[model samples]
Target: MNWIILILAGLFEVAFAFCLGKAKETTGNEMYFWYAGFLAALSISMGLLIKATQTLPIGTAYAVWTGIGAVGTVLVGIWVFKEPAGFLRLLFLTTLIGSIIGLKAVSSH
Candidate 1:
């Protein structure tokens, strides 16, 4: 259950991070909404992640949470924001995902 919450929190972290980038691209009222919501969500998610880390090992929890958030955010940035989507991007993401899985396996025992 706690791990589930941590993963969900990480997803929210990615969402807020994307919103922050989008907020920077916009102007006026929409900017305020995006920025505020992004910051609020980001903070809350971090808190939840920290709470989760109390039970889970810091290295494993942080690695998995951040890896998923970063990978998802980059994908979103590529598809939605038209950011670069090249082989290098895939390579790095793949490595990070593998590392996360390895760390999780080691931590489980």
Candidate 2:
């Protein structure tokens, strides 16, 4: 259950980051909407992280959450923003995922 919450929190982090990126180009009311969405997602994500930490070690939870966000952001950037999909970039993302899994496996939780 904690893992599930942590995963969703990470996804929210991704949403927050994406919204922030989009907000930069927006103006006035448009920017305000994106900013609000970003703030809401950020708050929810942080709340979930704090909750998950009650059951999971802070180090493990933080690393996993960041890993999820980073991977999601990279994938979203590639798919939605048409960013570069170079071989090296993908390889590093896979490596990061492997490290996240390794961390979880070794953790007491």
Per-residue lDDT over 1-109 for candidate 1, one digit per residue giving the tens place of the 0 to 100 score: 7788788878988889889888989999999999999988888889889888888888788888888799889888998899998998889988988987787778863
Global fold similarity of model 2 (TM-score): 0.95
Evaluated against the true structure, the overall lDDT of model 2 is: 0.94
Off by over 4 Å in 1: none
Predict model 1's lDDT versus the native.
0.86
How far residue 17's Cα lies from its native spot in candidate 2, in Å, is: 0.4
lDDT of each: 0.86, 0.94
Compute each candidate's TM-score over C-alphas. 0.90, 0.95
Displacement of the residue 105 alpha carbon in candidate 2, Å: 1.5
Which residue pairs collide in model 1, if any?
Answer: none
Output the number of the lDDT-best candidate.
2
lDDT of 2 at 23: 91
